[model samples]
Each structure stands twice: as structure tokens, then as C-alpha cells.
Target: MSGGVDSSVTAALLAEQDFDLSAVFMRNWDTKDELGADGKCEWEKDWHDVQQVCKLLDIPCRMVDLSREYWLRVFEPALRVWERGMTPNPDVDCNREIKFDALVQRLGESAQWIATGHYAHLQWDDATHRAMLCRSVDRHKDQSYFLAAVQEPQLRRFMFPISHMTKPQLRELAHARGLPTASREDSVGICFVGQKRRFEQFISEYIPPSPGKIVDEHGKVIGEHNGLWKFTIGESSRVSGLKTRFYVAKKDAERNEIVAVPGRDHPMLQCRAVNTIDWRWVWPDHDVQQVLALQTKLGGRFTTKIRHAMAEIECTPSQGTSPENVVLSFAHPDAGVAPGQTAALYLNEWCLGCGTITETTCTADLQESASSEPT
Candidate 1:
């Protein structure tokens, strides 16, 4: 439930139905080691809220500690990606690894179906005999992108109670029903990071300082960086002593250096193609064959989103260097496409699946002739 308004309302809505209802709050983070900014355990507070909501709903509730599962499955893997100077979407991993895989296993045969407050829909596909992940009616609040890595089996047993309604509508219902969390603000950003600390500050505690050089596009050292993990591609390189603003164009992990370019719309920031490793499809067999056949017969016909909230871009998918790898060729150069980020695939409103980007082909070559020009 996460002790949020959406989940509270979800429980309330379900209580009116005849189905057997039991609320289980999965504690993915352990706050015993570290407290919040207010010097109180964050998860404890959330668990309290969950208890209150469940009490009002009159459902049997329990707390399932999945911190160990989350640490081994999501956090550790994400830390490795961060150490390599690549962006990692931990939320996507949490949905697939913790929520769907570990939590479902914990329930075992006790629960027939799992429901959540995620703003995504599940549609049963008659042709494929599988469940398809679809976008919520609230387009702005759609979260299908995060669930792209979830396989068909998990999708079949999942349900979203608030998928058909908008955020405002849901909140209104919560208010009418007197949900305690009716006015509670929605949670944002990564869960463990919390709202108090900067991402760089939070990550620094786990990763030791590995200082590196920050170089310009011309290969001239401009400044020093505390760590490559602190910087992300396409974000303004807040390096001191620069007359004009610069943005991070690339992270050369092998050299332990960052490539910064002048201007926000620099050619070096535009990525023409993204190559993903360990590509996962919701309907693994059928979807793989479908994309391959489409590529062979008619180039490609798929839209992809490298990150959430951004509009999907038309892309042509083809087999990458290996069978497990997939290359998504963007129709237009995409800026800020970073390695380690999940590239979610979709056919219109239906989310097909996603892959973790391993490399990005940029448009830096087009600007080689103009590189010598003074900034």
C-alpha cells in the first residue's frame, strides 16, 4: 500500500465489493539503520499510516519485510550501475523484482490476485491468451512505463483499482469516503532516496569518492569531478569558472572522465541510437518473433520511451550484436539518452516491454568539423 492516498482509496474502493480483502504493506526499505531528516524512521511512519487505513477499511493487514529481497535484487544491482557511471531506474527494477517477483512468491497460494494503486491497466489479450499492460485513462499519471519489465505471468495476476479514474477524481472519492490520506501528498522520485537529500549526497554514502577529470568535447581538461556518478548526461555541468553553461555529453567510464559540451542543444548530446542488453519482453516468445518479423518485412513499427513522462518516440527495433541485445534506432536524434536507463517499448497505448540501455550512438561526429571553433 505504501501508506499513500492512492492505495488508501484503493482499499476503500475494494471494501465495498464482495471480494476477500487483506492489506499487506511491503517494507522494501529498512529505516532502522538510518532515520529520516526529522530523526524518525520513515518506514515506521508509513507502516503506521497503512495500519490506520487498513483499520478504517476493516481488513486484515500485515507488514511483510522485503528489505533483504530489495537490497539484493534492486539496490545492489543499481549501485553497480551507478559505480559504472550509468543511470539506473531503480523504480522499474522494484516493480519487477520486489513487487512482482519476491512479494508474489511470499504470498504463495494464499492470495489469488494482487492489486495496487499504480496508474496502469491490465487487459486480457484474446489472441495471445496473455494479459497486456495498458496505459491508464489518466494519461498524465500513467505508470505503464515502470511496469514494462514485468512479465505476462505477473500481469495476469495483477489488478489496478484506480486505473480507470484520474488523479483528481480519485482524490475526490477519497475525500467523500473520508480516507485519512485524502489530502496526503503523492510520493515522488526514488523511494529510498527520500525527499530530504540530494541524489548525489545520498549515493555518496554508499560509493567511495573516485575523483575524475571533466573534459570538454575537444578533449581538453576543464575541471575535476568528485565522482562520475554525480553527473548525468544532458544535465548542466555546474562546473565553476566556466564563462558559458555546459552540459554533460558523455561519460567515458574506461577513462574515468566526463565529456562536457557548450550549449544545451549540442550535437554531442543527441543520440541517434540506443543499444540495450538483456532485453525483456512481456510476452517473451510471441513478442520477440513479432518484432523480428516486423523488422524483416517492414523495417520496424514501434514507439519507445527512454524515460517516464516523456512522449514516446518512433523507433525501429533490430537485433543488436547478440540475440539478447536489441538496438532501438530513433527516427530523430534523442538528447539525454543515457546508458543503464530502461527503454520501454509500446504499441500505441499497450506497453510491450523494456530493456536496459548499454550504449548510446550520438551525433558527435556531425560536429567534429566545428569542434575547433572557440566557445
Candidate 2:
């Protein structure tokens, strides 16, 4: 359960309903491993805390090692995009690689459905024999965007216990239930790759950081940047020799230089097409067909998100050449969308699966996927 309040409360709620549960913590990231020869680390502290929480709950807990799978499926892909100067979303990749893809395969003869602490909903239709991914009731904590790439069929066996629970209610219940993880703070930063500095350093070991040029919108030289991976579209920060603080407006992988704008005149970031949407399982027309046809029932005005926790901007989806390559046009303008961010398409409150953001009418990428819509 990761020894967090939300997960602790989730276990409590499920237990109260008389559901037999055996919780498993995925050891996807070994923070100590990331630390290398740097001696013991704080991540070990987190690991100890997770074990203690499992003990207090009196539930059987085991660690599932997904290190290799994660490396192959998520980290490598994310690294590829980042080196290419795209701001890829790792959270979305973790969902697909660990939650839906690996966990489902690992369940084997034991578990029926995979459960996580994510605030999202899963629905099944026996009549239509279909499964749907939906947004959580709590808008603030909704994680539908992170799960936009979830295939429709695999969702049939998925369960989200926190779908309707608010963050406050979950915390309060955790303490009342005397769950050991109740007091644990929400997790922040990278779980496997470590912190920003750590991940960047690790990446540099292999990718070989190349000093690049910083330029303005008109292709005028502005300053010098440390590395291409260090900057993302719409990111505001220091650039040596720049008179004013700048935001990354564009990145040219070919020249290994970033184009920055003095202010927020970043009208050049938007693009066309959201290619390669996928789900947990196949539904008819899932290939490249849904790109164009959303059955009349699925079509309409929906909020399409380029990243998580940001306000959902309005969009309308239409049939495309490929089901995976559907096109969505924004109803209003939104800004700062990076090339590798996942643009999740949602209907009402339901997460109708999602795809990697190959190219954007506005701009962005799928979570953590390079070939498949990563997010």
C-alpha cells in the first residue's frame, strides 16, 4: 500500500466491507539502488515505514519486483524522449507498465482485479460486454488523465476504492481506523529515478550532456543552456546572459538548442493530431478506427487534458485516419503544453481510455510512451 494515508484508508474501507484482501507493494523503484555507492539513503526509511504499516494492518504484504519490466518499458522510453527534448510524463507510463500491463499479468491464479490508491473509477457493462475507465468524483484529486491510456477491456477487472472518496475523508478515516500509515505524508518526487538532480545526473552518465544554445522566437541567440534535457517547453528559469527570465517556447532536437520567449507570448506551441490512443483491452474499432468514430454516444464536447492536475480544457474529438491517431481541437486556448505530455480525452466524468500525445493541435506527448502513446 506504499504506507500512505490514502492507501491505508483504502485498505480499511475494503476490510470494513468484509472483502478479503492481500495487499502487495510493488518495489518498482529501489531508492537505495538509485543512490548507488552513496551509502544508506532516506528511501530506506520509506521502505521501513511501508513494512511497518503492513504489520499494523495485520494484512499479508509482499513486494513485487518490477525493476526489469519498469526499466524496459518505462524508464528507457522516458529517457529516449527526454534526451530528444520532449517532456515525457512518467506517471502515465507507470500506470501502463506496472498497474495494467504487469500487475494484470502477475495476478495469475491469485488475484482477480488490480487495485490501487488512484482516485479514478472503473465501470463494467455486462449487457454491452464492455468496460470503461472513468474519472473520480473528487475533481481536485481526479486521476483520469493519468489513466487515459488504459485499454477498455482490462478495466473490467480493475477497481478503484478511492474513486468517490475525498482527500479529507480519506485522511480522517485513516486516523479513526488506527491505520499505521495514516500519518504518512503524500509521496512526492520520483519513486524510482530519485530526485531531479539525481535523475539528471544518472541520465548524464549515459546520454552525455551536451551544452546547447538558447535562442529567441525570431531565431536570435539569447543565451547558453547546460543541456537539452534540462529544459522543457513552457518552463521558466535562468538562462545565462538573458536580460529577463525566460520560458522555454520550443526545443530543436536537431540543433540541440531551445527557443525561449521573454514573456508568455508562446503562441507557437500548439499543433495538430493526437495519435495512438489505447485501452487495457481491445474493444471493437480500438485499432486506429476510434480515431474518427466515437459511436455517436461517445462524441461530444469533452475536456481534454495535456497534463495532470491542470484545469481540463474543452475539446471535441472526431474520427481520424487511425483509431489510435484521433484528432481533437480545443474549444478555448490553453498554454505551456510540452511535447511529451499525455493529452487525455474524457467524456463527462468518464476516462474513455487515452493515447500517447504524438503531436498536438495545441502540442504534447503521451505518458512515458515513445511508440505507444506513452501516457
Tens digit of per-residue lDDT, candidate 2, span 247-302: 88778889988988776554554433444343222344453245335445556556
Candidate 2 residues lying further than 4 Å off, grouped into runs, are 41-43, 195-202, 240-244, 269-300, 361-375
Query: For candidate 1, what is the total of clashing residue pairs?
Result: 0
- In angstroms, the error of model 1 at 286 is 3.2
Model 2, global lDDT: 0.69
The best candidate by lDDT is 1
- Number of the top candidate by TM-score? 1
TM-scores of all predicted structures: 0.93, 0.86
* Candidate 1 lDDT over residue span 1-375, tens digit each: 889998998899889999999999998986556443455677888899999888888989999999989999999999999999999999999999999999999999899988999999989877667898989999899999999999898888988999999999999999998888899998889999887778888899899999889999889999989888999999988788989899999998999999999997888898888889888888877445686664566553578999887977998777877766888888898888899999988766778788999888888764664687788
Once all C-alphas are superposed, what RMSD does model 1 give against the true structure?
A: 3.6
Model 1, global lDDT = 0.87
Which segments of candidate 1 are over 4 A away from where they belong? 34-39, 287-289, 292-301, 366-375
TM-score of 2: 0.86
